[model samples]
Target: MVLDFGFLKTEMMGEIDACCDHGMMIWVDDPWIASFLPFTSREASAEVMQQYRAEVRETGQKLIEGPFGKTLLLSQVPTAENLAKHWFRRLAPRVRLRSGNRADLLSVVVWETPNCMATYHAPDLGRSRPGLSPRHSHSEKFPNEIGGIAGEGGNLGSHERSTFSQRF
Candidate 1:
């Protein structure tokens, strides 16, 4: 069902089969969709969870009509240390196992709010790049990209450090 559904019936079969065949349940939560699911019967609907898993398996092929549904691919698993900049809404976690099909074992846990993780984590406006932001990028690249007070010494210092030809 996961490999052949609507527009999802394509090369996605390989990825779906692989995950189903291996990639043992590493983590699971329901803060809203998965971790934050409600205690009510509606929120715990097996059908809803089944659909969610199918969409995750289908990934790029699946078309969903929700908030994060449009940007699902760009999201998920980041290599940077700035995951707190995004928001994830969990819906369902568990599903009903239909006959002749496999049931996946997923662990359910909640996420800790970034602010709650520390007593006094500093608020960062963020940099443009590693160890630097647009505000400071000029200092390292252009050096004298910005001008200083009447005679506080800005580009003058930058030029003094380098010859006219080198500055070019």
Candidate 2:
């Protein structure tokens, strides 16, 4: 699983763990972007964060062309000076992919819909939400399940907070 990120907040660790719970392996794309935030102000980070988030997302789609074998996460892409407009439009069609222009921070979770194709494909998947393998049943949990949550979205507590680059 590849988790793309933007100046994501410390609060989102729960979501990540829950997804991992569903038998998914998180890749965590663009971790470097978040790692850079502490040295600068929030305003400065948003521009850099947006551009990187978009770039990472586009990269994720190109690789998901084959059958589903692993849990994937594509974090928020930064759309700075040269945003990947064409690729962005290509991958995300069914979901509303928005970002925080102000850099307040962000998190991920899924809302189930009866006819929602995304859930069928990568139920609870964020970013690409790629189509699922035909052999797998809907009842199967992503390998990274934690209690009831799946696909890296788990019940996060203080121990996890250290992994997050806390923002002021």
Candidate 3:
């Protein structure tokens, strides 16, 4: 099972199969993805915390209606960090399971804030990848990739000067 960084291009069936077959939970910081999940009952919902499924669903739908759905504004920094964290959390537990050491069971706990990005926590892991945002318009491979407008010195452009100021 792969917890990918970018949106998985495949259909929903593949994601469902991953969850059912390998216990792969596809949680995203982006709320637009959440609107599709139905949470009438607790057990089958996508939320890490069962209680918040309905809230998540509503927030996702709102974001979908908002500009984030139409725009390509995705934060590459956050995406990569979350991706690495997901892999680390999943891999460590699988290793522990295979080694017959069940003492250190771990799960990726994601807290999704309504109308905002989600946050996840895992124990004892860190990674650093510099100058790698998809928004770096200078990249020939990722031209015009939107979101996270880092200007001079890798800081965000001045709010007054930035095109995203109004939306942000």
Regions of candidate 1 where Cα sits further than 4 Å from its true position: 1-35, 42-44, 60-168
> What TM-score fits each model?
0.20, 0.21, 0.24
Model 3: per-residue Cα lDDT at residue 118: 28
Select the stronger candidate by TM-score from 1 and 2: 2
Tens digit per residue, CA lDDT, model 2, 1-168: 222333232223433333333433323355543442333666766775566457656664211211233343344342321112222233223112322221111112132233221222223333322322223322233322111111211354322211112211
lDDT for each residue of candidate 3 in 30-143, tens digit (9 for 90 to 100): 565344444454454455333344443443211112222221112222343453354334343443443243112222222233333322333332121233232221223432
Name the lDDT value of residue 126 in candidate 3: 19
lDDT-best of 1 and 2: 2
Clashes of each: 16, 50, 0
> Candidate 3: which pairs clash?
none
Alpha-carbon error at 130 in model 2, in Å?
20
| Local distance difference test, each candidate | 0.24, 0.30, 0.29
Better of 1 and 3 by TM-score: 3
Greater lDDT among 1 and 3 belongs to 3
Judging by TM-score against the true structure, name the best candidate: 3
Q: Put down candidate 1 lDDT per residue, 9-93, tens digits, no spaces.
A: 2212333333323322211223344433322466565666666556655542222333322222223342122222211111011
Which candidate order results from sorting by TM-score in descending order?
3, 2, 1
